[model samples]
Target: LDRNATMKTRLTTLTWRGSASVDPRFSAAMLPWSIADIRNHESYVTLSVGVEDGVLAAYNTDFELQFEHKLRYILGYCRVIVKQEKGKKNADFLMPKATSTRPQPITIGNDNVAEIFGPEFGLVYLLKNPHDPLLHIHFYECEKYEQVGWVSFLIKAMELGKCKPSRH
Candidate 1:
């Protein structure tokens, strides 16, 4: 194989094995996962419509989708927020424990919230400046996960601050 092809194969090999590192110990309660997929050259990932904390993040970027799997869980959690309040209207997510406008050197504040929409998780952590506001609602041309019994768990998290699915 050519050098580029070899590198691509190696990268895929590494990327495909990423699920091995998922730690069930550390608290992934707050942020589900970082849908940062850098190896996808064919199919694209996407996020549904929703607001995170207070920031208005709604866009599509390739790598963002990789993180979508994680973010989607969070958003799915939000849906739980809505359901738990069934006889209610608005749902408020606890502010983030930290934030940053410059990516690195993340500061501390609830003003920072991230979101993924459209074909991927377009991260927008700052709420004051208002970066992007177009959550391309139709990024995934195909359905990824069936948004069924998944939402209830999120509601359970809102009430408890962490997702604790009742083990049967």
Candidate 2:
């Protein structure tokens, strides 16, 4: 359970609308550590994403949109999952088999969209193996599996515990 896997990794922050900003409300919310502390070696991450109504876009580090296009259907929901590199020698990361079967979808709507163009949710990732730090966020078309946009993140171990550890 204490094994360390070696691989070349690059972690970057997703820049949205010229800055890496999270919904203040989402950031201010609390995490339920009591529920999380039950499992040994378990950790979690809260992801905040912004979904736009038109022209799904991907941006480069310069704060410029790299890819933008209108999809056939409107984005309805998304899923966040913990992923790990396929092998020590492989650069590709894969979502675990167990997670593939029962991923909870994160949905944005009129009720939850707190502000115009500022819809957000606290997408939580309950990591299967606490040491492996990666996340895949995939958005899909309304009522369908048509992917609209996606982002991947490789969390640095040092940044994992920025929050004060639970006293439990």
Candidate 3:
């Protein structure tokens, strides 16, 4: 496991100001190792580019609130796996097939994820075709962590920006 994946990846400092600016608290309180470990799970996803980490919700989307008027649903962990015994090229990444009737797997193409967002906990992942680098999303459930992280991330962004943002 790469250690950086576990640590927080955000930070605020003169050196860090050039990248995208989200809440900096996420970067500050995190131990470097915890952010690093995340790479093995999620954070490797890069599509056409310009995509933010959280998937946007929509109108009547009972999951997240995207618009002031429309309902929004947030996107969570989406992974591609391969199954070893499935007789497919990347069979090992697949979730096991049921011996009898069971809930079917949720497998979607890479480009279509943005269109479909569902209850993160209720979502299921199945086998991926296993390329050298597959996109993965890791959803962390600690709002406390997010609150702390965002606060830290912002604080650092301000300080680094020379705005000298202060919280009391």
- Best-fitting candidate, scored by lDDT: 1
Candidate 1 wrongly placed segments (more than 4 Å): 1-21, 26-42, 46-48, 51-110, 114-121, 124-168
lDDT by candidate, in order shown: 0.25, 0.24, 0.24
* Per-residue accuracy of model 3 over 1-168 as CA lDDT, tens digit each: 432232223321110001121222332122122223432344322111011122111112122222221001211223222323355343122232335566224334333321112211111111122331332222221112233233223323432463332232
- Report lDDT (Cα) of residue 30, candidate 3: 28
Candidate 1 lDDT tens digits, 1-168: 233321111111001212112222322232223222221324433432222222122223332323322233322222111212455533332222334543322222222222222232122211111233322111222222223122222333333546332221
Please give the distance, in angstroms, between residue 62's alpha carbon in candidate 3 and its true position after superposition: 36
Worst 10 residues of 1 by lDDT: 6-15
Please write out the lDDT profile of model 2 over residues 111-150, one tens digit for every residue: 3321111112112222222232332122211111111122
Clashes of each: 11, 0, 44
- Residue 130, model 2, lDDT: 27
lDDT of 2 at 113: 21
Candidate 3 Cα errors over 4 Å, as ranges = 1-73, 86-88, 91-96, 106-168
How does model 1 fare in lDDT? Answer: 0.25
